[model samples]
Target chain A: MFTAPLVVAYPYKRTVGTLLSRFFQSLQEGRLEGTKGSDGRVYFPPAEFDPVTGRQLDEWVTLAETGTVVTWAWQSAPQPDQPLERPFAWALITLDGADVPLLHAVDAGDMARIRTGSRVKVRWADERSGGIRDIACFDLLEGAS
Target chain B: MARRDVAIVATAQRPNEVGSTLTSVELILPVINDVIAKVGIERQKIGFWCHGSCDYMSGQPFSFVAAVDAIGAWPPIVESHVEGDGALALYEAWVKIQTGECDVALVFSNGKTTSGPIDRILNLQADPYMVTPLWPGFDSLAALQARACLDAGVLSEADMAEVAARSYRDALNNPIAYAKENVTAEQLLARPYTTAPLRAHDCGVPVDGANAIILAAGDAARSLAERPAWIRGIDHRIDTQRLGARSMTESSSAAIAAAKAGVGDDRIDIAELHAPYTHQEILLRRAMNLGEGTHVNPSGGALVSNPAMAAGLARFAEAAESVFSGSADRVLAHCTSGPMLQQNLVCVMEGE
Candidate 1:
């Protein structure tokens, strides 16, 4: 059967709202931040509104670059456009001082190196941009099992 | 407010295939024709036409518009479209009938899943700012859920394998099933993980296929099929899109929808759950409080041959077929969307 590649593309500029704008700016500056929800919980990457209460949030909380993995899935074969070209674990890490977790890649080098509750810290990208990828990926903390 | 009774009178489906050379119109035409013919009704008699499909799968915008050609849109017809799943379109048709504007309606869906890199394509559905940048594959996300379930002591590798083994065995009886086997859970458990905590067998086998269902109100339904599968109760609920915001081990939205749909009101003879992953079947069963008395996924379910947009509607079709055939007294059909069963729709059906 004859076939041709269909590339679906619609390029447009997206204006990141006030909350995420601050969050992305903080990431580019090599600092972690979270938004305080209506409830006492602090959401990393800052939720514009509380997930449970649906209340708009504006209170920002500075968070540590270090965190612990809540849960993770190991990708043995990395795909294109992923954070890392090598094998890594896609983890949900609850950054210290934040109640909620952020989803990002953990460069653990090997599957055995990562686990639930594994300590990790942000590895800032050398060329910083005001985006989520500014963190590049998390690195497993040395001697912190 | 009083609600009008709606029943699924007829359904037609294409067997799941690894890949198909057929265009969306060609794929949907026969099933639409078959369903209309099965009900012994003229195409014009179908008062409303609602379709469910995804443009991401087709790699084009407004792809569903081209599919209406299969319905022969010459005389002009009342039609609608949903970007999600055909079951959601079926929901709209049900609402249309409830409004007394149309008595008979047709719902169809087609997915050319094999045309593109589906795993990579699905990443587009994630939160564009937060999650989409990483380009996480669908299987990787599912594996993450599986790992959470495993860590929380809610599921085990053995349990996941058992669901897969049972589904494969059940698929042998389904002629349209693309993947079927008689392997035991033990043999499956011995296999290596495709993604940690998830074996290849634990995931649904993706296929290219299409399906259609016809809906009619009260008297119209009675006149069409011998025993109409009455939709006694139906409800759809969604959880927070933030994957980390909610518990990955449980589906509270499914439970709420199941209760609202009265899933536990009467004993369920059979349940066709749209769980793409083996562990998700276990999770949904728990959420809905389905007991051992219910025969689950006798048609092999999405695990055997998942055709994306159509699989969910096929669950409705399969459950209705069981009721129509008199093999089951009361049945349940379920459909889920989003990452990790984030959005769920539960439908309960019964026959007199």
Candidate 2:
């Protein structure tokens, strides 16, 4: 069998659109923002249009850095380019004040530490960029109520 | 209501295999030839040609364009392509016939899912900014869904194991299935988890394969086959792209599609669901309200031989084969796209 190095890359950049552009920009500033849908449900990773109504949404709501894990799966082996180099839990976290949850990695240190309904807080990356990676991952909160 | 009745006249598929060295054209040509020969239709007589495939899976831009060589477009013929699964291409052909633009159409799809890191490659299908950046593979995402189902009390681990066990048992009769063995649910539960709450058996057996299906209008269909699987109703629906925003335990789009496709209108003898994960099959069973009487995944379904772009259409072919063989009068076939069953297509077929 023949083998060679092949790289699939997109060198060019594209705009993130109105709502998402703002969401990422806010992330870089070490804050969280969500867009309120017509149904009054706040969606994290703010969508440009209300998912149900299909209408444009501009109402922005500032969200807390802490959230509760709705559900999660333990990732025993981390894949390349993942949020964490070590083992972590892939979780759907509902940020405080937001009706909907967002998917991200949770650095629970061990499987026993993370569970459904466990509280987690964002752990900001030292280096800031206008992207989801700006927050390295979520961390388990100590003595979480 | 359909403007004109459309039926699947002929279908052919390459046996699912892992890491086949054949090129796209090589994989597609045989099936294309086989289906056409089965229908005994002249190549030029086919009013339209539709193809379904993915450039990402092929690792080349315009890869589907190269597959047209199998059809030999010398005189130039009416054709189309979908960047998704072959079942969607069949839907397009069905619509083409309904539009009075064509009486007969050819639909085909091929993919070598095992050529690359399938789990990592599938991560691209997720939301680019939010989920893709994290590089969460398909298995992990599916495991998350499985976990949610477990937490919600929708299904237990024993139930998931039973689905995998049944698929393995059913696949033994299917010559084309990649994975087949007479295993039990208890035995499956003994294996270690590949992704927690989801054993290796829970995931689809990815393979390199192709499938072709022929569609013809009322009279054309009657003449082509002794018994044609008439399309009673077909509908596709999509849920929100935001994965976490939707309920992971249930497939709302699947329910919507099943309703729109009139799945509950009559008793279904069989159901071929394209659920790659064992949990998803359980979820789809609930979504479509498939009763105990319905024989599910008799052809082993996606869990046995999942050829990415072709698996969905394979469900259609399998369901139709049941009708063609006089085994069932009415059947339901379901296909899913996007992560966690975000988009779903349901088709109900009956023999006349």
Top candidate (DockQ): 1
For B1-352, candidate 2 gives per-residue lDDT tens digits of 5369899888999999987878999999999999999999889889999999988888888998998899989788899999999999999999889999889999999989988887888888888888888898988889899999999999999999899899999999999999999999999999987878788899998999999999999899999999999999999999999897788989999999999999999999999999999999999999999999999999999999999989999999999999999999999988898889988999999998
Per-residue accuracy of model 1 over B111-168 as CA lDDT, tens digit each: 8888888888888888999998889888889998999999999999999999999999
Model 1: chain A TM-score against the true structure: 0.96
Q: Candidate 2 chain B: worst 10 consecutive residues by lDDT?
A: B1-10
Per-residue CA lDDT of model 1 for A47-133, tens digit only, reads 998998899999989998899999999898999999999999999999999998989999999999899999999999999889989
Score residue B62 of candidate 2 by CA lDDT.
91
Model 2: residues with Cα > 4 Å off, grouped in runs? A3-5
Candidate 1: where are CA atoms >4 Å away? Answer: none
Pick out the ten consecutive residues of candidate 2 chain A with the lowest summed lDDT. Answer: A2-11
- Report the C-alpha displacement of residue B116, candidate 2, in angstroms: 0.6
Once model 2 is optimally superposed onto the true structure by TM-score, how far is the C-alpha of residue A43 displaced, in angstroms?
A: 1.4
